[model samples]
Target: MQFLEASREQGIVTVTLSRGKVNALNESVIDEMTACIRDLAVDPAVRAVILTGQGKFFTYGFDIPEFLEYGKEDFLRYLTKFTNFYGALFLYPKPVVAALNGHTMAGGCMIAIACDYRIMVTGKARISLNEINFGSSLFAGSVEIMKMWLGQKNAEIAVYTGALYSAEEALGLGLIHEVAAEEDLVPRARRIAEEFAAKDGAAFGSIKKLLRGPLAERIRERERASLLEFVDIWYSEKTWNLLKEKQIRS
Candidate 1:
C-alpha cells in the first residue's frame, strides 16, 4: 500500500503507518488501513495485530491541509469512512494493540484508543485529542471510546483542555496502558499482543463483542448527526481559518 507497511511474525501481524514523516491520514491511508485490518480479521493464522507508525509520529492526525481543499460533501464522505473504520477497529474481533511510537493526536488518538491496548513511547512524543484547541470538534464514536478509556471526568478534562500529554501524564490519565522507552515500545506491545493471542480466539472475539457492541450501536445511531455538526463547525469561518494555519511537519 502507498501509506502502510504490514509484516507478520508467528501469529502477530504488525501494520505500520508510513505515509511521509508525519503519517498523516488521508482518504487513501484510511482505505488501506481498513483493508489491512479486515484482511487480518478473517485470516485464521493471524492471531493478533499491532498498529504503529514509522518515524516521529504515530500520526499527526488527518491530512488537514489536503482536506481543506475539499468541498463539504467530499469532506463529509471522507469523515464517514473515517468514523466507520475506527468503529470497526474498536470492536475488532481479534486482539489489536497500538504501539504509540511517537506523537498521537486528534485522529491518531482516536485510532490508538480504539485498540484493545495502547503502549506509548516515553519522552519527546506526546498524545492528545486536541481538536478543541484548533476550534474543530470530534465525532460521537471517538468521544465514546475516549470515555471508555479515560472515564467520564478525565475524558472531559482531556477534551476541554486540549493539552498535549507526555507518556507519564497520559498513563496517569488512563490514556495508555503503559509507557515504554522509545526503543522498547514495539517489543512491549508485541508481548502484550502475544499474551492476548494465547487466549481462545472465539472466546476473545465473543467477549469483545459483548463489551463494545452497545457502544458501537450508539455510535451508529448518533454518528451521522454528529458528522453533519462536525462538518458545519469545521467549515465555519473561525475553524477554517485555524485549520488553514495547521501544518504537518516532518
Candidate 2:
C-alpha cells in the first residue's frame, strides 16, 4: 500500500496511513500526509477528515533505523519538515478526527493528539508517548498541543510515565473521545463526525476558534520556535547514538 491513501465519500475524507506493518512516522509519511491534508483542507466537499491506520497497530513511532543513519543536517531537515506537517494539522480550519486503529506509541500517540478528537478500537493494543524511554522527548509543539488538548497533568503523565494504556483506559483518561468494538469502530466514528458535520460549519469552526483563541498565538509561536530548536538539537551526537541503539534493540 502507499504511504498515504485516501477516499472521499459524501462530506467525509478518510485518510489511511498504510506505509507498512506497524507503520512508523518518517519523512516520506510526513511529506505525503502534508500534501494530502493540504488538498483535502480546501476541498469544498470535504466537511471533515478521518485519519486511520491498517492492521493490528496504528503506528509504532519514528523509524529508528533511518534516524540512526542520519547526520546533523539530515536530522535537522527531517524535523523541519515534520514540524511543518504538524503545524498544518494544528491549525486546520476543519475538524480532524483520528480513528486509532491499534497499538499507538510514542510519536504515534502524539500524532493522534494533534487531531480534534480520537476514536479507538478495542483490543490489548497500547497507546502512549514512550519517547522518554528512548532518551528523547516530545517536540515543543507536541507538548503544547497535548497540554492544551488534554490538560497539563494528563499531558505530563502521557509524556513522563512512558506507560501504555488500553483502549478503555485511554477513553477514561480522555486521550480518546470514544472506544468501540473492532467492527463498530469506523461506523461509530462516522456517526460522531456526521453529527458534527451536520451542524453549521461556520458556527462549528467559530466555536473551535473561540475555545482555542486564547492559546492560538502562543501555540503558533511555539510551533515556529520548535521547528528551529528541533533543527538545532538533531545535530547532537548523543541523539544519533541513541537512535542507533533503538534501532538495534528493535
Candidate 3:
C-alpha cells in the first residue's frame, strides 16, 4: 500500500499515514507527504483536512533501520525530513485535524500537535514527543514550538522526562483537544473539522497565523539545527542500541 493517501470529498480531505509495520516515517513517506500537502494547500476544494493513520500505529517516529545503517547522516536526514514533513501541517492555511488511531509517540505526537485540532482514542494508546528517552534530541526549534503550543510546563516535563501520556491525561494537559472511544475517533474528528469549516475562513486563518507566527519564525530560523543534531546522534552507540532494543529495522 502507498505510504500516504489523500481523498477529498465534501470539503474534507483526509490524509492517511499507513506505512506498513509500525507506520514509521521514512524517506519515501516523507517525500510523498510533502508533495501531498503542497498539492492540497493549493486546491480550493479542500476546506478542511483530517490526518490519520492505519492499524494500531499513527507513527513510531522515524524508521530506526535507517538510523542504524547511515549513522550520523541518518540523523541529519531525519531532522531535515521532519522539518519539511512537519512544515506542511504548520504552514497549511486551513484547519487540519489529527485523528490518531494509535501509537502516536515521538514524531507521531509532534505531527498531531502541529494540527489545528487533535482527537485521539482513549484506552491504552500512548502519545508523546519522547526523543530524549530515545537518546535523540529534538530539533532546536521544536523546543519553542512545542513549548508555546503544548504549554511550557508540558514542554519541559515531556522532553526532560520523556514520558508518554495516556489519552485522558493528554486531554487534561491540553496536548490533545478531545478523546473518544477508539471506534468513534475518525467520525468525531471529522465532525470537529466540519464545525471549524463553518467558521469564517479568513478569521480562522488570521487567528492561526497570529498564534503560530512567532513560533513559525523560530522554526524557520533553526530548522537546520535539527539536521545537525540529528546527524550527531546518528553516531551515538546509545541511539543504535535503542533501535535494536525496540526491535526496529528498515
- TM per candidate comes to 0.98, 0.90, 0.92
Better of 2 and 3 by TM-score: 3
Question: lDDT of each structure?
Answer: 0.93, 0.78, 0.80
Candidate 1, residue 242: lDDT:
93
lDDT of 2 by residue, 31-85 (tens): 8888899988788888988889888778888887877667767877877777777
lDDT of 3 by residue, 1-250 (tens): 3788777769998889987867988777887887888787788777888999988888888887665656455556656777777866786788999998888888777788788888888887888888877777786666766786668877899889988889998888888889999879999988998998888777888898888887788788887866676667746788757767774642
Q: CA shift at 90, candidate 3, in angstroms? A: 1.1
Over 100-212, each residue of candidate 1 has an lDDT whose tens digit, in order, gives: 99999999999999999999999899999999988999999999889998899999999999999999999999999999998899999999999999999999999999999
Q: What is the C-alpha RMSD of each candidate to the true structure, in Å?
A: 0.9, 2.3, 1.9
Off by over 4 Å in 1: none
Q: Give lDDT for model 3.
A: 0.80
Clashes of 1: 0
> Of the pair 2 and 3, which is ahead by lDDT?
3
Per model, how many backbone clashes are there? 0, 0, 2
Per-residue lDDT, model 1, residue 247, is: 56
Q: Any residue pairs clashing in model 2, and if so which?
A: none
